[model samples]
Target: MSNFKITDIVGVIPALITPFDENENFDEGRMRNVVDFLIEEGVHGFYLTGSTGEGFLMTPDERKKVVKVVVDQVNGRVPVIAHIGAISTKISIDLAKDAYETGVDAISSVPPFYWKFKDNNIFKYYEDLSGSTPLPMIVYNVPLAGLFGFDFIKRLSTIENVKGIKYTAYTHQDIHKAKAQIGKDFMVYSGADEMAVSGLFNEADGIIGSFYSMLADVYVDIYNNIKAGEFSKAQIKQKIAVDIIEASLKYDYYAVIKAAMKWMGFDGGYVRRPFNNLSSCEEEKVKDEFRKIRDRYGVEDIRVLKSI
Candidate 1:
């Protein structure tokens, strides 16, 4: 049987960033605090080691460490989806199996990149990894992975235990078509942080985003508003998120977030090598704008929420 029931996965799941120390090592303490903060904020689920989490940069051992830390910290309060994508099929399968054993609610992977392959090969990659673990597998489809379109999604969705796709693009019509073709139960999570409400309008089951790590309450508000048939309110929340995201893009996006987390009194550490940390001047600007974001949104001081 599949490890994760389809209904168990939904809503504003944050694609959590990995906390790293000055020495460029994973910082467990910082990670724990972030997890506690997110759960306390009422985020529906957690997505670890994805693009925003720098999963692509981490070694297999490092990825496993992240999974263990997050899963233990969460302790079944909500679902945790682990992204275990590697360029090699064997590595992806091994990571999938390891994440399953480490207790993630589901596993996700990006298609093979930096090399050309037939559609059949891509399908085989997902097919092998999906069967390697009972945990449901989510396909990460973005332009970076060649944007497996709706028809391909229909085929991929047929894989045993392949539960869904983290649809990262803005093609809402295709998302609508895929849902109609495959039936409503096939999960479609919006990975595009900016157009989140649009995704839901097109019938995405929920949203999984990196920005939600900081503005989860806003995203959750958007989700709840949509569910309550409050489209206008949902659009308002979406605009707030877009504004914050626009501000975050001012510098290195991940670096800005790490800086923002620190400003909020959470233990957001540093980004690893090759991804430059923000310069001091840029960081101050981000902090200044982040405060504006909170002010504009009328959000409470999240730092006062108390860390676990």
Candidate 2:
């Protein structure tokens, strides 16, 4: 049998932020705490080493260390989806294999960037990575990366081990089109934190996002409240989440979140250099706004993951 398809595990999958210590080294202690915090905050699992985690910024070795820290902490309590995209297929394959050996539940990869490739090249990329390990692979489609569109996804999704997609942002129509093409059992994870409600409403099985670094419960509550048929509550929470995203963008996004993690006592450490730190000026404004997001979403300071 193929490794577990994503539907077997779903919801509030946070693309984790990489924690860095003063030396610009990966901070294992802080990384573990962040994983624990998300698990406790009702996040179902982790989507590691993505844009939020600065996966693109890290060396291959650093990426492996980050994945190891998370898998080691998660143990069996939650599923972990490791993102292994890099400039080379070899590095991506090695990372996918390493994550599988280290005990991650699944893996996803963004389409290769920098050197734009034809559909055939994207096809081969997924073919190679999925074949590299039995782990169910989700093709990450981030147009912002300038590497993806529907044709590429349709081609990649056919790989036997390729189970689904984690699309950066798509209209309900776009998802509908994908739904028709990918067919049953191939999960579609929503990438736009802003579009979670609409995606889940249209039947997306899960979510993979950078915003979940701080807004874990907001994402969860929106889904739970909707499934519970509490539409009013769900909409209110989603609005709060969007507001948080807006405020987060206003501040330095990573800086605001690293600061939030520290405030919550999770030791989220700091965003590595080249990403820069969130300015103290924006930080002051964001804290107040963040409090609003927390209150609006009905996420308690201490929470637990709902049984998936």
Candidate 3:
């Protein structure tokens, strides 16, 4: 019966992956299983249909279905933030409206890709999208969408419904500066999974990353360790996190994450076209390597991870 407020949107929020069946259709059951898995693992929140979820590649209908299924499966256990960003303001608005009506706790968006829009144009895109719904908006700043400069980020913080920014850059100073410039009430979720310890130590309220779908407990451990003022222990956990991340990156990222999940008995089915899942031989190789990573990091099962 508990629900999270904007201020409560902190800690290990997984950047959830979009599961597809062998036929490349949205596998609702597998998606639902992923939702339930994260919840049981004690994730603090869920970011649906973001980069990790392949939102950009999905049709509007697929995106909506994902949001609906995740929100329904989550059933108010924690906050569900949907990523509704698209190539144009109109599409983003439509997706935003759908996400809002589908009962997401909030909406987040990356800037328009494949074009060099001026700063004002980019600002207007977010402004228009934020105005499309009452749901709070978190600006997603990643390299692919053009990095959001501090000036632009500061301007965005002033937007009426703009709640926060998902900082994905390599610098921890950006997190610190955003907090100082935007004021403490504005939430900043570290989108880089490997830098979670740095983000938390620099005062990021939470973390949202693709890796967390399988590694939630370890990130939660880092969060808790940092919050408890156990920096030494948190540093050790962060090292473990980086190690896991490095292992996953050796292959196709989404493919590797999905394969790792599959290895743990969760249904991370084939990735859609334009991005292929591991072949039989590659899967066997990656699985053998991941097993070592898992054993070293103590990643047994998602369901067994201690909850926050």
Query: Model 2 misses residue 245 by how many Å?
Result: 0.8
Clashing pairs in 1: none
What TM-score, computed on C-alpha atoms, does each candidate reach? Answer: 0.93, 0.90, 0.93
Ranking by lDDT: 1, 3, 2
Candidate 3 CA-lDDT value: 0.83
What is the C-alpha local distance difference test score of candidate 2?
A: 0.78
- Model 3: per-residue lDDT, tens digit, 193-299? 88888888788999999998878777788888898999998887778677767866877789877776776668777788798788888876665665676677675
Question: After superposing candidate 3, which stretches have Cα over 4 Å from the reference?
Answer: 1-3, 291-308
Cα displacement (angstroms), candidate 3, residue 186, comes to 0.5
Q: Which residue ranges in model 1 land beyond 4 Å of their true spot?
A: 1-4, 291-308
Per-residue lDDT of candidate 1, residues 127-146 (tens digit): 99999988888899887778
| lDDT of candidate 2 over 1-308, digit per residue (tens) | 12344677788888899989877789898888888888988888888888889888899888988887787788778888899997689999999888888878788888777886777887888899999988899888787666466776677777888988887776655666777777867788888888888887877887777778777877788878878988888787777677877877875587777777776667678778787776666666677666665666655532211110
Q: Which ranges of candidate 2 are over 4 A from the true structure? A: 1-5, 288-308
lDDT: worst 10-residue window of model 1: 299-308
